[model samples]
Target: AQSVTQLDSQVPVFEEAPVELRCNYSSSVSVYLFWYVQYPNQGLQLLLKYLSGSTLVKGINGFEAEFNKSQTSFHLRKPSVHISDTAEYFCAVSAAGNKLTFGGGTRVLVKP
Candidate 1:
């Protein structure tokens, strides 16, 4: 299957703590990576991506990940998080369709 998989659908953490949501994908010929975050009642915003080069890629809001070609995985990580970080995060892939094939989704709850 040409789809990305998010292992954790939800992660709860207190404010100023660290968190990580697992993500994996089926190997592909060519792949473009992306992570979008939907905060509260907001739409999805691009967090980061690994289009090419450099296994490690950084994105907005203190987030980053490494594109592991061998493992076919790209997991998001944040050293320290804030309450405002609470939101629904989606890992997506686009191999052919203009539309993105999103993972189930993961909700990051950063409580005070």
Candidate 2:
């Protein structure tokens, strides 16, 4: 079984500033991790994922995440944020052939 937790419930950042969204997971078996973003009044969009090789994974919109086995974490980061980046982010984990487990979600508020 696998479970995901988002360390922060909300993150406030200024435009052009860097932002990091912390995510941790617990699992006994091999797992796949994913980050998703949900814009206001919109469905979730895939931001990044870590399924196999390479500790660093890059996603759309200039976002990236590094998967750490020792820490059991997959934290997302963006060098610079924009007002359009304001949204809810979710961390998810899934063991092979198992259903995905999602975190509560963290809301990112970008200030102008």
Candidate 3:
């Protein structure tokens, strides 16, 4: 079984500031990591993913994450955030032939 944990429930940051959202997962088998964002009243959209190849993966909206296999962590980061970036972020893990297990979610509030 695989599970994801988001250390923070909410992250408040000023606009144009850097932000990082912590995510950790546990799985017995090898798994793929992903980050998704949900805007207000909107469905989730894929932000980034780490299936193979480079440990550092970049995604849309200037977001990026590093897959640390040993630590079982895939934390999301943005060098400079914007007010439009305010949304709910979710981390997920999926193994071969298995469904994705998502984290509780972290709400990012970017204030102007």
Candidate 4:
């Protein structure tokens, strides 16, 4: 399956709690990985990306991701997430292409 996997479609958490959204991919060729966050009725913002080098990559809003070739995974992790972090996260892949094939998306809900 040359597709992306978002292990959780919906995740509810208390405010200022740690959260991890799992992402795995199956592809024969190398691909560019990306994590994007989208708020309600808003466009996507690039949370992070694993482009060429570096197994561990950091991005905006205190989010980071690790690229694993063997496991074919690039999981996103945040030590402590805020209420503003509540949004829809999408994992995507693009192998030398501009178009991105996104997962179903994981919803992160932060409770008060």
Candidate 5:
């Protein structure tokens, strides 16, 4: 079994400033990590994922995440955030052929 935890419940950042959303997981088996974003009144969108290969994974909208096996962490970062980046972010983990376990969402508010 696996569980995900998002460290922050809310993050506020100025527009064009760098931002990072922390995520951690616990599991006894290999798992896939994912980061999703949900804009206001919109469905979730895939930000990035760490399935296999390199530890550093890049995703849409200039977002990237580094998968750390030793720490069991996959943290998402954006060098510069825009007003459009304001949204709710979720961290998820799944074992092979199992359902995904999601962490409590983190809401990001971008200030001008």
Candidate 6:
């Protein structure tokens, strides 16, 4: 079995500021890590993923995450953020073809 933990429920940052959303997972078997963003009143979109290979993976919208196998963590980061980046971010994990286990979610609030 696998589970995800998002340490923060909400993160507030000023526009153009840097931010990092924490995400950790626990599983006995190998799993894939993913970061998804959902804008207000919109569906979730894939931000980045770590299926295999390099521990450092980059994704859309200048987002990147490092997969630490030993730590069992995949934290998403961005050099700078925009007001439009305000949304709910979810961290998910899946083993093979199994269903995904998602975190509680982190809501990013970008202010002017």
Give the TM-score of each candidate.
0.92, 0.97, 0.98, 0.94, 0.97, 0.97
* Candidate 6 lDDT tens digits, 1-112: 8999999999999999999999999998899999999999999999998999999999999999999998889999999999989999999999775898899999999999
The C-alpha lDDT values of all candidates are 0.86, 0.95, 0.95, 0.92, 0.95, 0.95
User: How would you encode candidate 1's per-residue C-alpha lDDT over 1-112 as one tens digit per residue?
Assistant: 4788999878999888888888888744578888999988788899998888999899988999888878888899999999889899999987653557789999999899
Clashes of each: 0, 0, 0, 0, 0, 0
Residue 106, candidate 6: alpha-carbon lDDT: 100
3 versus 6: better TM-score goes to: 3
Give the alpha carbon lDDT tens digit for every residue of 1-112 in model 4. 3689999999998888889999998788888999999999999999999888999999999899999999999999998989999999999998665568899999999998
lDDT of model 3 at position 19: 100
Q: Candidate 5 lDDT, tens digit per residue, 45-72? A: 8888889999999999999999999999
**Displacement of the residue 107 alpha carbon in candidate 2, Å:** 0.3
Kindly report which residue stretches of model 4 are placed more than 4 angstroms away from their true locations once superposed. Answer: none
State the RMSD for candidate 2: 0.7
Q: How far is candidate 4 from the true structure (C-alpha RMSD, Å)?
A: 1.3
Whose lDDT is higher: candidate 1's or candidate 2's? Answer: 2
> How well does candidate 6 score on lDDT at residue 88?
99
Superposed model 5: Cα runs more than 4 Å off:
none
Model 2 C-alpha lDDT per residue in residues 1-112, reported as the tens digit of each score: 6889999999999999999999999999999999999999999899988999999999999999999999999999999999999999999999884898899999999999
What is the model-wide C-alpha lDDT for candidate 1? 0.86
Q: Determine the C-alpha RMSD for candidate 5 after optimal superposition of all C-alphas.
A: 0.7
